[model samples]
Each structure stands twice: as C-alpha cells, then as structure tokens.
Target: MTLIVDQSTINIQVLFMVNKETKKALIEKGAEIIYLKGFNNTGINEILEAASVPKGSFYYYFKNKEDFGIQLIDHFLVRFLSGADRRLSVTKSSYIERLRVFFDDFLEFFKGNGFKGGCPIANFSLEMSDLNENIRKRLDTAFDQMNNKIALFLEGAVKNGELPEDLDTGLVSNFILNSWEGALLRIKLTRDVYPMKLFYNFVFQDLLNFN
Candidate 1:
C-alpha cells in the first residue's frame, strides 16, 4: 500500500521551502548592497527595502546587523574562493597561465564595474575592522586564506620549473596580493583603470623575470 501525504502538510512544507529561498535571496541582496555602499553607509532600512524583505523577516534570519555582516562576509568568501579554485585547477593551462587567468578575470571585473567599488574584503576591513573584533578576525582569516592559496599555486609553479627554484613563494604571493589591493585602491582614488593595467603589466613582466 502507498502512503498518502497530507495536502496541508505539503503546503506547509512548500511555504517553508519558499521562505528559505527568500531568506537566502535577501541575504545575498543585502550582501551586495553592503559590498557596494559599505556597512556603515548601508542602512538596515535600505537593505530591507532593496531586498523587499520586511524587518521581521530580516530578524527571523539574523540575530542582529553584526550577525548579518558576518554571514555576508562568509557568503562572499565562498563565491570568491570557488571561482579562484576553478581557475587554478584548470589542467590545460600552465601554472603561470592559470595565474594570468586569475588576474585577468579580476581585471575584467574591475573594468566591468567601472572600478566604482573595490575589493569587498578591503572595503569591509577598512570600515569595520576598527570597530568590530569578530569582523576583523574574520577578514584577517579570509586574507590569510587567500594568501596561502596563491602561495600554494606559486609553489606548484616552482615545482614545475615555471618559476625559479629558489623563489620565495610566500613572499611572492604576499607581494602579488598586496600589490593588487593597492592597485584597486589607486583605481578607486583616480577613477581610472590605467593604474590597474600598469600594475598587471608590471606584475606580469616581473614574474617573467623569475627564470
């Protein structure tokens, strides 16, 4: 005999599923707004209005604004890391080519967005790190993770003779990440992509000198 499910129960389950998606959509939208405008500049009302989510629904998903900010950072990190992992894992590309692909993707994104907003980590670190210890620690961990991942890629390059055997992978990774951050800041200040392009060119040429 087949077991029959209650229609009312099914309706309740459907509503629950929809509510979960709605909550995720709200958080994603809220994160985007915060990334663009910054945490301090993005008021709760604006996020709620932008997400078309009521205050009650926001509270249902988040304990407070700080909690929401943490989740937002986590969400952004997942997306960013996933893309980086995909680019770095491509088998057909040389290690150096993979690195170039990574940087080129970032450059295209910056150019596409008109460099209106900079890296989300950099933006959040500047805005909330001073005021929030938890957020500061999270941002710090994210940066460390990014640096480590790049360093691992560099280590692979060295292993494959793509880079100098004696090259300091850790330092090189830090330099690249730090330089990119600085380039992004310059882009924001100058309202131009020339600085970013120059940065990429300098980095590419410098890496070629590794042999």
Candidate 2:
C-alpha cells in the first residue's frame, strides 16, 4: 500500500493548519473580550489586537463581526463541553454522582472567577436576540445543545436507577438549564455565589429528591 501524498496536497494541509490556528486564536481572544465587554460593546479591532492578528485581515477570517460571533459561540461550547465531558465521562461512578460533580465543577469555576462575565450564551442571548435574527438563531441552537447535554445526563441517571424511569428528562433538563442561567445572572450582580448555591440546593435536593 503505497500512500503517496502530493506536494499540492501537502501545501493545502499546511495552510489548513495555519488557518485553523489563526481562527481558533481569534475566537478565543474574541470570547474573552466579548464575555467581559459584551457583543455590541466589543470592537473587531480590539479582538484582532487581542488575537495579535493583523487589523486588515479580519474579513479574511470572518465575514464580519456577526460571523465571528457565531463561531465564537461554537468555540465556547466546545471548550465548555470538553471540560464537562471529562468530568462526566472519565470518572468511575454513577451518572448521578458525575452529574452532581459536573455542576460543582462549574460552581467552583464561577467562584474562582469572582462571578465575573456571567454565562456567555445568556449574555449573547440578551444582547443579540432582538438586534439580529441570525445571531439570535445561532444562540438558540447553542442553548438547545446545552439542554440536550443535560437531558443525556438525566437519562443516564435513570438508567443507573438514580432517577425514576418515567421522569421527564427533557422537561427537567430545560428547567435545570433555565434555573442555572438565572442563578448566574443573579450571581453576576450580587458578586456572590449565594444565588448559585441556592439553585444547586433546590435542584439536587428538592427537585431531584436526592438525599
């Protein structure tokens, strides 16, 4: 099996690698600025500067700020879910325990950040939903994906006998996500974890009926 690769193919592969790194850098830096300043408040120049990309090449990488915003949402989801996947999948315990730890992990993440930059998805949802339909729809998909992930965790709990088979995981996951974002919003203003702590307690204790 002689797998002979061509020079043009090799060049294309190298270009893809370069472009991928550049794009990821833009999204990462853009996320940091947008998370703090907000989508409207953030400027493309600022993002390019933070990313160390040339000022004139923003269009080469993205159609415009709105396009960048969509990719930024994707990068945020991937980074967040990668961490969550580790916490949920790598452990040797029931999904119920893993799910609880997943929440706790994010709780600690917020506490460590001093409650700054509330949920990026929620922030973008509020800022862009009415202003741009395209961005709003992208944010909607991101939120749905999050809900689906939680629903999967709940389904796992049921399979493990930690939750009732008849439990409505879809409804429960949506509620849990809503409650979490609401708590995050409150925590951002309060600069305290009390709201999140309360949210956690109500979900795991009263709602989930965990002892």
Candidate 3:
C-alpha cells in the first residue's frame, strides 16, 4: 500500500502530539512536587525545571499558575474516577469488597510513601480554597465529582441490599469522603498508619456494617 502523506497534515499532527505530550509532562511533574510540597510552596519555575521544560513556553500551554492548577485538578479527577470505576466494578465481588479494595489501594500507597503526601485534592483544598477562587471552585467541583462517583456505587449497594435500604447514598458518600480525607491528614501529620487503619475499620464495621 502506497501511503500518500501530506506534509502540512503531518506537521500539524506532529505539533499537536508534541503539545499534548509537553502539557502532560508538565502536569505530571508539577503533581509530583505539589503532592509533597503544596500549592503555595510550589513554584511554576520549579515545575518547569522538573519537567525539563523551557521557561517561556509554559504560557503557551497554560494561561497562568491558576490555569495549571485547574488543569491539574481536572487531570486528577479523570484519573481518579477511572481508577475508582475499576476498583468499584469487579463483577463477582461484593459491593463492600469493591469499596474496600479501593481504600486498600490508597492505604498501601500512603504506607509505601511513609505516610506522606496525602490526598492531592485535600491538600489543594487546604491551601488554595481560601486563596484562589478559580482554583477553589475547581477543587470544589473535583470533590463533588469524587463524591458523586462513590455515591453512585453506594446507591447501587443500597439497592442490592449490600447496605441498608434506608441508607442515604449521597450523605453517606459525602461523609466517607470527608472522613477519609481527614484520615489522610492525620496519617500525614503523625506519620503513622493508625488513623488510616482506624478509618478502614470504622467505615466497614460500624458505618457500612457489611458482613
């Protein structure tokens, strides 16, 4: 098969791909640093340096740091929801087991990291919500997106008798997210797994009450 290649089309394709790769690189590098440091403590130049990107071209990809932060939240939301969907969708598993698998993944992650770098969204919320409205709003929506996903799963569990029929999925999911984020904060502060384990225990045994 003879391939007819247009030079202009090829150039556009290459440029678009490069742009996407560069943007993803920046977000990934930035997320790495911001996870350890914070939104206020982290600088764009630092992210650029980590990404091995030139100084001037950041504006080419993002309008500003706020733009970058918003993009980061958006990127995180997509990745998080994807993982949640996977962890919460095992066909043969009980709904409770599916949720336990989800938390266990994070439990292992924080333990491996020595209990540092808690939830990225919670970190951003603590640092940026009072400071930047755009970023705050983006973070707000991200939390809601997360809650909605968990609630959707919980709603299914309620319908299937895995949870009580009277259970409020929305409220329960909101509480679970809040408590889990708080647990992450505690573990990060104390550098201990006790709080994380505590959350896992109470959530499953007391609140959800699943056998």
Q: Pick the candidate with the highest lDDT.
A: 3
Q: Give one digit per residue, the lDDT tens place, for model 3 in 30-54.
A: 9999989987799989999999999
- TM-score (all chains, Cα) for each model: 0.90, 0.92, 0.95
Ranking the candidates on lDDT from highest down gives 3, 2, 1
For candidate 2, write residues 141-165 as lDDT tens digits.
Answer: 9899888888888888887788888
lDDT of 1: 0.84
**Model 2, which residues run further than 4 Å from truth?**
1-9
Q: Who wins the TM-score comparison?
A: 3
Residue range with the least summed lDDT across 10 consecutive positions in model 3: 87-96
Q: Which whole-number lDDT from 0 to 100 does residue 156 have in model 3?
A: 73
- Model 1: which residue pairs collide? none
Clash tally, candidates in order: 0, 0, 0
Worst 10 residues of 2 by lDDT: 82-91
Candidate 2 Cα lDDT to native: 0.87
Better of 2 and 3 by TM-score: 3
Q: How well does candidate 1 score on lDDT at residue 85?
A: 92
For candidate 2, give the lDDT of residue 189.
96
